[model samples]
Target: MYYSREVAHQIEKLRKGFPVISVIGPRQSGKTTFLQHYFKHYSYFNLENPQTRDLIEQDPQQFITLNPKNIIIDEVQRLPDLLSYIQVHVDKQQEMGSIVISGSQNLLISEKISQSLAGRAAYQNIFPFSLSELQMHGLALPGHLDQMLKGFYPAVYTREIEPNEFYNQYIVTYVDRDARLIKNIQNLSQFQKFMRLLAGRVGQIVNISSLANDTGVAPNTAEDWISILEASYIVYRLHPYYKNIGKRLIKSPKVYFYDTGLLCALLNVVEPQELATHFLIGGIFENFIISEFKKELSARGLPVPLYFYRDQQGREIDLIFESKTKLIPVEIKSSSTFNRTFFDAFTYWRKNIQAEISGYVIYSGLDSQKVGEDNLLAWNKLDTLIDHL
Candidate 1:
């Protein structure tokens, strides 16, 4: 079954301008599906097959010669050197949207693309399915716990696989197979522990020393593994907003998993019911909301990136979306009960930043009330604020 992706619109728009479009994201992010669905007329190549990779390695020019002028290359990073040949082929072709390439690793694709196809290609990151995307596919959003347990991965829904079983195999395959493409892990057990440690800290400030201590590895090892994880689309770090240079604030970046279901697996969350009273329920809930906001902005062609705000006094704002002229503050709470206290961070934001600020509170509760400046939103309607911003 083919499902619609919101980011496809942006890819379609970019296709009209760039000669080479590179789609990079985690494995199973539907990069191939999106490209082939939209660009059905182009010739497609899957470099993962041993024979196809061998053929390309044997004679790059010959392989290029036999393929159609417009082509789709999957897992292009498997042959990074072939990008130069792709560049030459793209340079000679005057047509826009002549070639599309998809890769799993950003660290591999971005550097090679910057080197060989700098001005020749436009890159796009394809994360897992979003809430709206799933809804569009005829699957209504389940309760918060179910969402956290099942996650936003397309396969989990489509294949109807058991979340616990799927994630178990996913971790093993990702670590034993995909992770090696970046760096060799001497001890897979330690790597797994490192993941759990990071997962435990989702929606909290990233602390390398403590994480290393907990995982029983050197901080440097943890750092390297974190990089590999980020490049592999397992997790991301949100930088703190420091627009007020003179204000003393916490400089640490908060950690988040790209998919909450994976985080659940790491934390040994076997069932959705466990998530309700789970100690990290707040963190997991915030993770889902923050990632939803991030995806919305990225898919909408927004120029700004996501940031957070905090001061030495321990005051914190969950998310800050900044543009050339505006600062948007979003606060998240996991409690079902709504209170006036949730607005404290936004209140602090309003006072500290002289610029225009839009405020929103995404709470687990369904009830909503308008504070003086902040608009309370049910968790279901997070995209409403995200779309407008």
Candidate 2:
């Protein structure tokens, strides 16, 4: 029941060019399964086992000496210092695709790679299933709300685990285990509270001071929690587009969950029907469309180049794809009915920005049309927007 991942070709290309390839993503994103499936000949080791960890920690050189080539190491962050030994082994061997390292903690893995495996390892991010990936298997749910609730995690489809059940365990494992592994938080309960509060603020600009007050922690503590969330791939920050704008723009980045299904779990939206009347439906939908864009861009091994634009006068565009010669503005709406007013933000931004390539309005509707110079797209036609960009 294994669905093929879209990044396989990109990873293969990287392996041909680098001695080591690091597969990074959130836990349960299927890095281990994918690596095992794709690199069948590569010897595998899971550092999570206490005995295995001790064996390597005791004599990393011996471990390397025994299994120096075509090896896949899972949870490599368990022994960050072991990377130095790996660095030496790869340098000595000068072999392409000799070692593969996988980890859930992006910050630790990336930092260690930069310090120890610099110019030796290439990185490939393996996030949860993207909409396009699911569609290839005919597993994509009927409605957008249902898709958002069920989420794109591999287990939800491959293991047939219920969304609530999987996310409940995911939260507990992440908050209890991964959080402690990354930083020391005396109050785990408070951190959980902070997570729920941040969930409510999705698609909105982060206010660290206010979040701290709501979470009953110091502003610095809240900020640190935010960093931990980002590092863990639980959330991401969408920065605003401020280049060449004459007016004041918002400085704080808007927060979004990497997976909308987890976002629903945090907000207590158990059923798809609940979204129809839910207050956060708009934000949730916005998160879904934006995350899909991210998945599409990542799968193609392209730069995100994605940003949101906001001015002091309250004018804003939901998404802006900035490139060297063009700026693509996109507006997202949850409604099924098309409205001409959706283009107002695009209209306003066009006057000040000279690098305009085009604009788009994506809504939850069946019909797509064109108005003026831009395109209006149905939500399901997101790939078309990606193609245009």
The TM-scores of all predictions, comma-separated, are 0.95, 0.96
Assess each prediction's global lDDT (C-alpha) against the native.
0.83, 0.89
Best by lDDT: 2
Candidate 2, residues 152-264, lDDT tens digits: the string is 88998987689988998899889999998999988888899899999999889889999999999999999899999999999988988876553224378899999988889
Q: How accurate is candidate 2 locally (lDDT)?
A: 0.89
Per-residue lDDT over 1-389 for candidate 1, one digit per residue giving the tens place of the 0 to 100 score? 88888887888888888988899988887888888888888888899998989989999988877874779989998999999998898788757888888999889889999999998898888888888777677674557778878888778878968877788778888899778888888788889888888898988888889999998888998889999999999998888888664331446688899888889999999876788989999999999998877777677667777888777788888888776768788888998788888887766676777435659989888766677766999887776786675
What is the Å distance of residue 261 in model 2 from its true position? Answer: 0.7
Ten contiguous residues minimizing lDDT sum, candidate 2:
242-251
RMSD of 2: 1.9
Reference-based TM-score, model 2? 0.96
